[model samples]
Target: MSSMKTYAHVQAKTTRWKLDSKAIDQGIAYGLMIAALFVTYLVH
Candidate 1:
C-alpha cells in the first residue's frame, strides 16, 4: 500500500514537471522568434 502511494506521488510530480517544462520551451521559442523579427526590422 505504501509503495502504491509513493508511485502516485511520483506520477503526479512528474506530470506537473512535464507541463512546466513544456510551457517554458514554448515561451523560449516565442521570445526567440520575436527577437529575430525585431532584429530584421531594425536592419531596414
Candidate 2:
C-alpha cells in the first residue's frame, strides 16, 4: 500500500514537470518568432 502511494506521488511530480517543460518550450518558440519578425522588419 505504501509503495503504491509512493509510486503515485512520483508519477504526479513527473507529469507536472513534463507539463512545465512543454509550457516553457512553447513560450520560447513564441518569443523567437516575435524576435525574428522584429529583425525582419528592421532589415526591410
Candidate 3:
C-alpha cells in the first residue's frame, strides 16, 4: 500500500514537471518568433 502511494506521488510529480517543461518550450518558441519579427523589421 505504501509503495502504491509513493508511486502515485512520483507520477504526479513527473506529470507536473512535464507540464512545466512544455510551458518553457512554448515560451522559447514565442521568444524566437518575436526575435525573428524584430530582425525582419530592422532589415526592412
Candidate 4:
C-alpha cells in the first residue's frame, strides 16, 4: 500500500515536470525566433 502511494506521487511529479519543460521549450523557441529577426533587421 505504501508503494502504491509512492508510485502515484512519482507519476504526478513526472507529469508536472513534463509540462514545465514543454513550456520552457516553447519560450526558448520564441526567443530564438526573435533573435533571428533582430539579426536580419540589423543585417539589412
Candidate 5:
C-alpha cells in the first residue's frame, strides 16, 4: 500500500537514537556498583 511505503520512508529518514553523556555516566556508575557487589559476594 502507499501508506505503508510512505511510513517506511519516514522511518528510514529518522535520526538514530542517541545516549547523552549524563546517561552514559550514570550507566557506568550503576554497572560498577553491581560489579562491586558481585565481587564482594564471591570473596565472602
Candidate 6:
C-alpha cells in the first residue's frame, strides 16, 4: 500500500515537471519568433 502511494506521488511529480518544461519550451519558441519578426521589420 505504501509503495503504491509513493508511486502515485512520483507519477504526479513527473507529470507536472513535464508540463512545466513544455510551457517553457513554448515560451522560448514564441520569443524567438517575435524576435525574428522584429528583425525583419527593421531590415525592411
Once fitted onto the true fold, the runs of candidate 1 whose alpha carbons sit more than 4 angstroms away are none
Q: Cα deviation of 44 in candidate 5 (Å)? A: 0.7
- Give candidate 6's error at residue 28 in angstroms: 0.4
**What RMSD does model 4 have?**
1.1
Question: 1-44 in candidate 4: lDDT tens per residue?
Answer: 99999999999999999999999999999999999999999999
Candidate 4 or 6, higher TM-score? Answer: 6
lDDT of each residue in 1-44, candidate 3, tens digit only: 99999999999999999999999999999999999999999999
What's model 3's TM-score?
0.93
TM-score of the candidate numbered 4?
Answer: 0.82
Q: Kindly give the number of clashing pairs for every candidate.
A: 0, 0, 0, 0, 0, 0
Please give each candidate's TM-score.
0.86, 0.91, 0.93, 0.82, 0.56, 0.94
Clashing pairs in 1: none
Candidate 4 achieves a global lDDT of 1.00
Candidate 5, position 8, lDDT: 86
Candidate with more favorable, higher TM-score: 4 or 5: 4
lDDT (tens digit, per residue) of candidate 1 on 1-44: 99999999999999999999999999999999999999999998
lDDT per prediction?
A: 1.00, 1.00, 1.00, 1.00, 0.81, 1.00
At residue 41, candidate 5 shows an lDDT of 100
Ten contiguous residues minimizing lDDT sum, candidate 6: 1-10
Question: Could you give candidate 6's per-residue lDDT for residues 1-44 as a string of tens digits?
Answer: 99999999999999999999999999999999999999999999
Q: Which candidate is the best by TM-score?
A: 6
lDDT of 5 by residue, 1-44 (tens): 99999998777656222345567888999999999999999999
Report lDDT (Cα) of residue 16, candidate 6. 100
Residue pairs with backbone atoms closer than 3 Å in model 5 (clashes)? none
Clash pairs detected, candidate 6: none
